[model samples]
Target: MNDKLDLKSTDITSLNIEKIAALFPNCVTETAEGKRIDFDLLKQELSTEIVEGNKERYRLEWPGKREAIVTANLPTTKTLRPVREDSVDFDTTENLYIEGDNLEVLKILQESYLGKIKMIYIDPPYNTGKDFVYKDNFAKAGNEELLESGQKDEYNQKLVVNPETSGRYHSDWLSMMYPRLKLARNLLTEDGVIFISIDDNEVHNLRKICDEIFGEGNFVANIVWQKKYGPANDAQGMSDTHEHIILYAKNISFWNPILLKRDEKQLAAYKNPDNDPRGVWRASDLSVRTFSENCYFPITGPNGQIHWPPESTSWRISETKFNELLNDNRITFGVAGTARPMQKKFLTEVKDGITPQTWWHREFAADTKIARYEMKDLIPENVFDTPKPSLLIKRCIEISSREGLILDFFSGSATTAHAVMQLNAEDGGNRKYIMVQVPELTTEKSQANKVGYKNICEIGKERIRRAAQKIKESLNQDSQDGKGLNQDSQDLFNLGNQENQANPGSDNVQANPGSNIDLGFRVYRLDSSNMQEVYYKPQEYNQATLDLFADNVKPDRTAEDLLTQIMLDWGLPLSLKIERKTIAGKEVFSVAGDSLYACFDHELDEAFAKEIAKEKPLRIVFRDNGFKDDTAKENVRQLLKQLSPQTEMRVV
Candidate 1:
């Protein structure tokens, strides 16, 4: 049996390169020091034609381009620290709210969420010169660099301003975003898509990098969203009234965006003028710009007037098709029956909804003003400066994802979370979200501080709480008015129940049968690994120091910390339900309801292990130092194997 502990976290980028090497051995070559990619060989293997070095290519480059690549490939010795007190319904919620530097968070999430995210919508720093862009120090370790920077407040996050006057202004911002985006792409499913909110300041640069990362062919659309209603009369040149939302897919061939629901105004155009049995209908043009010899013939109107195709235009269909449509009463003329011929399009014959347009209007999508008002309504005393309206995010969610996982790493003010809840309530979807944000401190003189919000994360968590309460209240009101949970809601509620039964001890709070909304999220903060550095680098420790180190785990680390680290190592979702149960008076954590059972209590005996084995957990873990002696440890392992032969066991 393997007795030594494995405290190292997974190196995600290296694993990716290893996967590539597995597929193409020739493309992977080793240097004198370590394994590295043979790019020339890789390019030759991938293409029929080859291009030599120093040749002009269609690509984007910056001052720190190479350094940015190095930053992304470097693995970090960090872990997510669960904070139960900072969370709402930490044990039961499917959602996640991570308070940390998003870059590190993305790296930590690589294992558990790889290729699982359905959609990602990030509103990162617009690079408008005033936004704080993270500065990663590649020379030093992440924890060491963070501590030395003195940027960690109570939240342990560092934020630095990237002003336009700086020599490497654009390079700094690009470097900050490059690695994060690269990591985020790894978490997207094959059919997944990402939407990034940006302004004119860096939209061009953002698109170039996204093309490089997600591939140019996967470019979906650059939606122009009208964010302002009235113009800024006092402008430098032009009044900026819109922002761009750049979209890209993991694989364009596998992605198909959902259609948006048609508004009442669009539906109003269709009318049952003739009381047609097919239903409401609208008149469509019967001519097109293309010239077709078969469709050049003229047609006689109801009043015996000759109707020819407009100048340089031809009939939309062939003569045979037109005759068939006319025979079926699908063609129409004006009310007087003397106007030009037209085609009647019945509402039922068309799609259930309208195709999403590239241009989003302010009315339906909601404007910045409305977004401000929403924040005001939630926390009347204070409001975020530029929160995206929930409706805008709702539209993105509806288009990009249905009932799958959504993520927003730059989830300022938690508008994305609020939008997810609101949309779930509206469509009865069980879509979950993961929100990550640095606890950027609020200015002391700002309204947020005056209202008791110390950081951006505080505002975000509160927003989710208030948003959920509002949704529940609305649902209750609807129920009292004779409109109870819809069929979709009931179905979702049943699904939740089934999951709950499958994982018996996972959920502490069960969902009410009448309500099918999940409005809570677990909270996890970024921190150093649970194990002490000396555990991994034992050569740095002297014999005397090693002898004194009975336990590899840090003195301040708790059982929960060890459990979360194990979860990460096992590639388990951080939001998985965890339950604390007692076995032989010793507290055992039942993760995801027997998926994993662990006990960190010291001086553990064989009887406790056997009692836990009786449950037949899929996996079990114990602290190495928890046992009284070597004999106790061997006895517990033998008993567990005899009782639960299938259970995989490990130790911290």
Candidate 2:
């Protein structure tokens, strides 16, 4: 296979254009430059009615709107390099923490994670005139720019700050968000949902863009979360104490958000005062504001006084149904039975939990002060400026997702990762998380820099480490308190035990309940592809140049690097469990328990090939130069065909 084009991501715009051309051949035309679409012809082909050009239409527009579309369509030549030293559990964890520009990271993830993510939660810049926005240079090649940025060094890329003085202040923020949201929408499953946190700064604009991207029909709700407890005393005018968490579903009809668990106060409303056989029950108002002639009836109280529906009001149910309900003791009155009759909703008959409401009070979800305290408790130094409380994110996870992949491209402070771990601990879920953050550098004299955090990504990674330890400790304590570890925990601990046996003296290692939880994540850093440029453009090289570039892979790349690239090419998840074993004195990497097997050794003989073939992996890969000669390569292929006819074999 050609390595150059095959290594890059799919060109989304070209595919879209091909789809359009297939439908309307007449509208597809070639220009002096390249293939071009005739808008007038396409419009005519789409509809028989005349389309007016000057007519006013309802649509969101900005200075860089067209450019934003181009950005999302462009394919990147970037790849994620595994950082084993930075990872918590390099070979076993199903969670991932990606450090890079989220836009490039999203492009790299498109093939492997498309339509697989169940929920996405992002807290992007609020565009408060001081926030930084990514400056996407569509003209430049992605690989060249990424290389020049020095991926391994301290983050020094200049982030564009959209100050109020800039001519395209609002436009810049919108432009930055437009393409990212479009890409994010593609990753969501059919029943998936996305929650975006934003303040009043650009809430209206955000809603318009989301309606266009996710469809107006899929718009779920605009939840008003009390982010702060009380009004700011130093406010110039009215204090802004709340933020909006806009939610949208991939397919609204298919999505059924789980109900929120009932808190003590909500459960307290139900009482078994009368010793009813149906357990505890709560009273509900029986009157309705709408004038329903059929429901405009009354009932006689136990005190022998007749009670009629209040003025301009009617019973919630018809008189016939009310009679049946009263006969079944589904109606309630005051303690003395003198007040108006009400409907009785038995706790046992109702759902186990309560439906989520649009307004989230600070008491249920934590406030800003509580969030700060949480950060302070974990890390003595406050590195993040506005770290969200874990409870707030926990609620979002509980409602939208259960046991599927969750992504957060704009994962500031890694709050989503922390919340995912906490929720998994509570409910024994196998939910996994993918957190992507741009390594935006901290201020020179800021607390983060002084405390040894060079960039935001450092703070985020550290937070996950601390959060995992804390969760494991808490779970272990619970186990000691006689609440034995759940099944999920036990399974995780067994896996951890197995891993610990393989690799000894790893940090943060614990026993029993602590080991059962997957509090570890694989870390990957975004960088240029492992293949050298000469591999893609071999025709430009002469005999001497070709000799120097004989091996298409870069000199610095390792066996693990090629394995990761193969995973991406094959659309395998980066978090898949990996194992390395020595067969016939040759090291072989096994991915996902025989789903894929690869040997990147420099030299291979017949014995090693036969040993690998005997295992019958679904897919196998080898280095082109690994074979001793042409005879060796043919022998290995013949052996594999005989031993495992179903296995797909490839060489790099």
Candidate 3:
């Protein structure tokens, strides 16, 4: 077998040689006599091997380490595709709408976004008798099947649903979820938090898994939301309408959960109509927890008759506290001289302490009626089913992430995204959202699928579009006075779209195109090609010459952009070096960084990638796309792979 495989190494290191072999196992297939032949067959195999090999190497190598200093005038532009009437691109806006298996989508996200997310909220399958389990190829490693699908095997199923009867019910759920959760955790910021909505079927199991991922110490609370208003009328006796939303923080110390505000609406319940100096307050009986002998003692009243306290009841506060309250004029006696002594609960003096309870009643959260109404209002004739109320999600966002990025991996009907948009609209705060949903083939069995929708993700995208339009229309209508139209015409996604004039009017706000106007989100699909690869044309011109040619094109500036710099500086092709790489330890594009020894596309396991990033190059270039694992993506070499691994890494 060794003789048949006539493999030899040159200047190429053992690592690169091994990488080449892994890409093509049949590089040295021979005849029975061990005679070499079939140059055509060998060339075809080698060419195919090189194609995959270069992509992997390009993804792992850094451009900063290259010997040359010439610019790489490689193409840099995204490929926009039409999806069911909508055009999507990477620069559309900050919000993202991916249409594919969420697991794969999460894997792709690890490259450009790791440790950058602020919050994540997901509503996974409950796995009840009717819940479908996801089939993940846990036995296989990496994304080999994903990369080779369709082109090689049309019959191959990338993803499938396992029935509830499978013996590996819990195992299957955990297996399918483990990798995704690990990846999701990487996307969170140090001060980030995640909320998972589940039911009795796997709440305990979910908690255990989350504890393993987010750490047990970060567990926040298990909030129970009232899903319905009335009790069950069925024969079994009881109806369950509530579900649980479990919360966990990336780091508890960094995250600050907000206290529900004591707004005017709630404060209106208290009254000061009688002009009492103590301010607005209500009345309550001052009670004790213990059968106190001192509290039970009889007291002399204005009527001359001595009144003794009830034998069974005692004051709520300690004797010392009660005496202090009496001394401070806080304790109130009966309106008339004959009433029992009570205490004035002044609204102004008390702190509005919000204790998030396990049972979420209708008053605290949006009721089912409101949830249904919200769906009907946004969607005509109710296109989707069981959409969560904006009010409910708004409360969650306000509590968990008052000001940060919010993610919804299971963005059913884009409820969480809509909630984030609505929150931003109300407070005028810039909060971004990234949504992921599976484009599972839809059928008539489902209401949304029946009405022209092909998958759950389609409904999600449409919902966001229609919802945004409605939000915009409402904002236009609610403007103060007649100047509402011009007061706030800017979009929710586009920030700083407005321009500033040299001399501004007292109330004049500059209007900038594509600025204040919500440019709508810049959307990029997980499978979409990187801008450089799509635009690069290597066959027509040599990249080395392209960099030098720029001088003739324009000599006034005597400077070049990253693309040109990469071509001249590194013998590595402009299309390759100015790519994505693992610098120091994090995933970044090299054209954007200033470091020597550029490992343009550095794999998470590559020590060379970290070493080069740690040594900071004048500039590093990397393939716009690379890295398949989420956990490994966060190891950024800010300066050193250990302490400062963050280097400038740009996508061509």
Off by over 4 Å in 2: 1-53, 141-158, 482-515
Candidate 1 all-Cα RMSD: 13.0
TM-score on alpha carbons, each prediction: 0.85, 0.85, 0.60
Instruction: Identify the runs in model 1 with alpha carbons over 4 angstroms from their true place.
Output: 1-54, 141-152, 482-515
* Pairs that collide, model 1: none
Comparison by lDDT, 1 against 2, better one: 1
Residue 423 in model 2: lDDT: 75
Regions of model 3 farther than 4 Å from truth: 1-92, 111-113, 138-159, 235-237, 263-265, 288-313, 337-340, 444-447, 480-519, 528-652
TM-score of model 2 (CA atoms): 0.85
Model 2 residue 430 lDDT score = 74
Give a tens-digit lDDT track for model 2, residues 1-652.
6556556789787677789989987766544344567787788777879865445579986667889999999987778889999899877899999998898889888888999999999999888988877777666544555464334244424256677756466777888899999999999999999999999989999999999999999999999998875577999889989999999999999998899777556778999888899998889999988889999876888888898888998888998999899899988877789878988898888987878899987655666666776777679897888988877888899898879998999898999999898778777677899999988888888999998998898999999999888777677776676443233333333343352242111112123453346789998888778887876777888889888877788889889988988898888999888999998888999999989999988678788888888899999999887888879998989889998899999998
List the global CA lDDT of all models: 0.83, 0.82, 0.56
Superposed Cα deviation of residue 619, candidate 1 (Å): 1.2
Compute the lDDT of residue 66 as modeled in candidate 1: 82
Give the range of the ten consecutive residues with the poorest summed lDDT in model 1. Answer: 502-511
Model 3, 1-652: lDDT tens per residue? 3557547656354455346556665553223232223344446675745432222221211122121111111121222122324523232355666555566656555545667788888887667755544455433533576453321222223544545544345555666566667778877889888888888778887888778778989999898988766676882746887889899999988987766655445566677644679788866776554687656655444466555556686666655776787787665555555666667788877766454456766545555555666666566656665677666677778776656678888787888888777667665556778777765555568776667786666777877887777766756555533332223322210111122111111111222221232324433333333223214554666777555442221222111233333332342221122235544555444542343233334354345455664455654444333333433444443334453345445434
TM-score: model 3 vs. ground truth? 0.60
